[model samples]
Target: MDGEPVDARWGSARVRGRRLRTVRAHAFAAAGLLLAGCASMPDSGEIRAVQASQGVDSQVRVFGVPPADKATPAEIVDGFLEAMTSDDPQLETARKYLTPAAAKSWKPSSAVTVLSSGLSRVAVRGEKDPEGPRWKVTGKKLATVDEHSAYQPQTGAREYEEQLQLVQDEDKQWRISTPPSGLVLSESDFQRIYMPVNKYYFAGGTLVADPVYVRQRTDPDSRMDPTTQTVQSLLAGPSRWLAPVVESSFPTGTELRTGTKSLSYDGQNTLRVPLNDKVGNIAQPQCKKMATQLLYTVKDLTGSRLDQVELLRSSDDKTSSLCSVTSVSADAIANRPKIPEFQYFVDNEKRLVRMKLDVSSEDQQTRTEPVPGPLATVPVFKVSSAAVSHDERRAAVVSEDGHGLYVVSLVGGGPMPAQVPIGRGGKAETLTAPSWDASGDLWVADRDPQHPGLWRVPGGTGTPERVQVAGLDNRRIVSLKASADGARIALLLEQDANSRILYIGRVERPDAKGDVSAVSVRELRPAAPQMADVTAMSWAPRGRLLVVGREKGGVQQARYMLADGSMVAASLPGATGLSEVAVAAAEDESKPKPVVAYSEDGIVWLPPGAQWRTVAAGGRSPVYPG
Candidate 1:
């Protein structure tokens, strides 16, 4: 798989070549080529240049003209595995190879994009050999580190045999052939290597094909196939593929659990976990996993809900369990303790390593209550809606005061969040809705005399921009907040006295096009017919939004997850807190990213941690099905 293409590339250039079976075993050969366009060439001469010198050696050259030439195929194989399972995938490795064209065509999608999966070993079949002799190389899936998608699996691997078809075009430079025929491959076969979709990254024989993962006919947990091809993910586990740390912070007394698999890390990190009952000294209330969910986080890892931990009932299952987390997880350390979150840290050996604590009041409580003090008359700004940015670097808060939005910096080590003014700037307006873009840009709905429209503020500090509305005038609507990624905005559009329509719009661009015309509804939330009206509304991670109301459906707030009109929205798995939610959003976009909330407790609430994303993303979080 590695050299076959290179040989063909050289062949296309009309270069006669002999296949060498090895590369050096010492230099730690790292091979990665993120080329996007093999189809573009101005002339034959340009193609010929590649043929002149591009060919992999079969044996370890250890010292050659190029760097990868000196590394062994084994080293290359092990290295990728090491990176995926250990040091973590660094996007820059492939970022270095993004051709100008490739970068131009790049469209950010909800799914993680892998730049390239390469191989070593330079084997080639003779002119006449059965099955064209195997082309082998090590492979690993490279992905963007999204805390929300930490639960999503890296579906690629290394150190495997592949069926390759090296296309020798007229030019002599080997070019990867065009895409394969869909109908030619069986549905079952396609899912394994080709696919009804490309989730596995197997191109299927034109370039290369291999069994990346398989359903075992016998053991459910362990597969009798190549470990490299094992889909340890769909089964359940952190991206690290072992018992991973769920989060670096957690709500106090929250339980934590691991998956049912043997976990280890980096070839050296091991866990001495107990399969019989619980792990001793490794956690609070030692010897615990027999009953409670394990809540833990190491002191060195600053993980957010994107970081995670896995549980193993036994060391044999492909996957045991996974936990959600809420601290920036690189090293275990103290996290921003504004809201309640839970985290757990464990090793590949299924042993617990560290734990962190998060805190929040009960679901029924509101305002965290005034502690019987003389400051009771002062209005307590309770959290109405909340959203954590992609990196967990900051949290967006919407409260009941005129200070429309606030950014809770997870890194700055602050007690009280720094506030941003959103209202008329002079009066005490109830600042109650906030959201964020992936880059930590702040979007808040400021409600008061003059500042009654949706506003935008970047995290680094700058002027706020007004989100334009088409049909409705500025002062007519109370508040409007954008979706988590800032692709859409949810607004409480005014109709008359008793009713208001909540609209989410596809914002063209806040800086250039003040396009207020792109509004559509994932679902239209109704205001109460009795008592009063809709005060504030928010779109949670999924298509679910919490609206403060006074009517029947308003008082006893019912949470609804609206699928992007095109699909079906799932109601949150088990949401309890309901004092008053001004806003909410999907934790992330990968696995079942939860509906995070700024609870009635004046603090925010999130899923357990790490296992936040879900495959059922609405693409436009809570965006209308346009």
Candidate 2:
């Protein structure tokens, strides 16, 4: 029926010669028959009219226990329905009661289109009664759909020719429509209903997350009753929606907290305290709720759909909680958490809104054998990021899984050094660096493929456009970070053979027409002559570069240049963990000293002097807020 049949054998097997000549007359006859059949098609329009008339037929009569003349409408309807479907031993129904044809209603082939969802239409129709009286019915439906979709009335809807309907027949004493064998199975009872939709379906829909629970309604031939939708709306209706959760602090259901400490970000003051009541399926619910709101805001404010969020405790670098907007990343083949995966966040007011976790696990049983007697092994981690607002008012940390990003208050003063994604994981390909602007609108750390520029997110709530440079040598970039003044953007990119390169660039904001551009500012490389693959770098507020490397000497300060590289100055004693140290220009001019941070001997250390004074028995990355 979908198409026509072809010759069983093409080319040679097609009819020819005597066969073709003999078949022309038969084919002609068949065509004539087909044409005749078409010409003789019945008047379905008239049939439909008759069927509609039957809905209120005056000729039909019924003999039942109830007296027709005295029976009430309800009683008559009940009796007729009984007779039409009579299946008892005392009563039997026959097939003669049904009309030969029935009116068929369906969606209109040519219907109105919907330009938008907000359109509304009102209609009032009146029908004349048998006594020259008229009855009117008023109704309304979405008018916008007239332009976009095709909808229809119920299948059994009919324009009645006879005036008497839904009332008792004087003879039959019943008001029931019947099928063949007098069965009361007509389509009149099956009325169409409305579509069921909730407020979240319209307001909370995540355009990028694209959760599977959401979908468009396209039912030219709907299988469900339309009234159900109206009923649902009546029940739940609309309201101001609830805000999303952004931050949280909790322990897993498997473990309970005997001691939970509320700490701050001070390198020396932040510590863990035990809580006795924290147990299975039992977390700090208030904290978790706050975390959820913070995390969702991270998405709205930052304008990036993330994979995971985490919450970490600084005491032992444990993951206290975790969250992710999406279950996993797009390229994730199985279950692998990528690095730079967790994001740290902040709000417009410079408050820590979101946090990331920093947790790790290693098999101490096997590794212990490699060390000497009384040897012990433990895992460690660094909470990578927490997203924030443009003004840096609020901040949050994301877990390695990207599930939930927890909100933290850099100002309200809650637990300090709180992380989001708590579990341990490695680096990944997409690291959306969170940024805050003067207005509190969020921005992202994005890569630039063209001209090796920095992709800084413009302030607003919309799709992020990539900012580019005119000329440079770079490709396949993945990470980014912007300066405090919004002047510079630092980028970490993937190079040949799993290597990485860092580049700095300046930004040019949009004009009255709204456009942006980036320019390379400068480059940071090994200041040491040997320069054995520097791992990372940080810019001090005092305008100095904190570079990391595995050089032979300690306090290897030097003037770095792209053309010639760095020159080592001197070496100090007992500085073995050079690779684990991160340096920053010393603050407090009265006590100006290079802030040296490193981890060793079950303790994180941050020394104040250029000679490594070991200020904190356990601390790392002692950030001095600007």
Candidate 3:
């Protein structure tokens, strides 16, 4: 059964009111399974499609078949490999192909190796084994999801090889004696089995999103639905890459009520979560924060809109409600940055200009006006790149020669303040660009080779301090952008003249009583490992980045990627020849701000569901308030 031809092809079935276009092939391997476990398949036949009705929801569902009696060693190996990709709740069907002792010891959740294609199995020609047989499984690895569900993309296709040993049971039945340490799945199978969800944690006074992959349906090992699994992950604490910069509201030993396998929202769209005794004494203020985290973490799951989250204390007799928070109340506790009021850019006159966000292309000939106050009326230096404060009251601009940095108030007319002391007037690479965080601190990178480092302006007013960035060995920071939450920062590092990579780093500050001067950036993680070169990137809504770059040997294009570096979340529609891009931070996700880009044709805007249209004829840099 190593290379036997398959008998089944793509077919259709009705499951609950939706139609399923069943996938019966895995890459070049013949890995087909039936919806019902006991259904019999053809022994030998050609693969062909089975026609079915259209106009129904097209969802894919794959199931596994149990091993047959008196199966051969090769057949058992093939059956087990295919079963690993099935919809087994606990992977129990796949374990049937293993020896009783081996099944008891194997742990599938340890790690996940994602391959570009299905595994190819071949018998070992000369290996002598005490067991019945030996087989080699090999494939090209694309990525790996760690035990923490953090996804890391491999720079290139890496070879994956493992050996499987088989033995004969007491009844003379073939079974796998030694199995792989963890799961090995194809790319398509991994996407179908798991989905990315953002688990919220506290970074200072604001909530930060940490992306992790969880099973879409009931987890095979935990037997918990997606909602319950997400809550447990949140209680487990932040991922290792993000742990140093964020904190969780839940108590250290907190967990769900004993034997809580599933959670659901009531008819009023309120979810009641029962916690263990560890949280029974939690204060009202702290309990509200815990519920706020749960409300945001599980909001992406498939269900009705969640209006509120109620926490209850588990007891021997009856649980008592600890605290509750509605959507409106939770937003107040989250403390997100204020939404931007207008989009800003440097126009043809080399002066900063503003345009109302409410004006769309449909409106005839939208007018552009210079920003209020001294930066526009009084001449200082030609504006090149700029960053607006979260409150939309102050603007940070870099001179055209990239030598000077200035912070000008958008309101109250006055002379532009003197150039920031950190900027050294000499060459174009002296300063990259400026970015603001939620704490009102300004961040910029000085690319001067002799003294290159990241600089932070305290509250956009106080003395400039050089920030210590760990893990930045000999890499020059060309550009930088800070997330609105102030916990994460994205940097474009120049490894060489040809290679530029994008990385997301955590911003860490000293404890309350510790030295306040010890603030630093830590643990820079790759945000776009698959892209060979990254030219530009901006922080988008919900802790994602809109990156403009290209893969190795490919043309440049714009795509949106999760900050966790898992996978490309989306591609920018109709985006081309982009040199710079900016996205407004909106509080209401349902109505997103238009995406602005600086292209060869000048500044262009992409309204939701529409083509990119020219906004400013000679605009060079476009930015929205951070």
lDDT per model, in order? 0.32, 0.28, 0.78
Candidate 3: residue pairs that collide: 89-220
Q: Which candidate's lDDT is highest?
A: 3
Per-model TM-score, in order, reads: 0.32, 0.28, 0.87
Off by over 4 Å in 3: 1-58, 125-128, 154-157, 359-361, 364-367, 512-517, 580-590
Off by over 4 Å in 2: 1-383, 387-393, 402-409, 412-429, 432-465, 469-481, 511-532, 550-576, 579-598, 601-610, 613-622
Candidate 3: tens digits of C-alpha lDDT, residues 128-229: 455447777787887888777767666555998888888878998888888988888777667767889989999878999999888777888999988898
Weakest ten-residue segment in model 3 by summed lDDT: 9-18
* TM-score, prediction 1: 0.32
Which tens-of-lDDT digit does each residue in 199-315 have in candidate 1? 111011000001112222111213222121122322222223111212111222322233324322222222222232222124432222211212221211112222333333333
**Which of candidates 1 and 2 reaches a greater lDDT?**
1
The candidate that achieves the highest TM-score relative to the unseen native structure: 3
Clashes of 1: 108
- Candidate 1, superposed: residue stretches over 4 Å from native: 1-388, 395-401, 404-408, 413-421, 425-428, 510-577, 580-585, 589-626
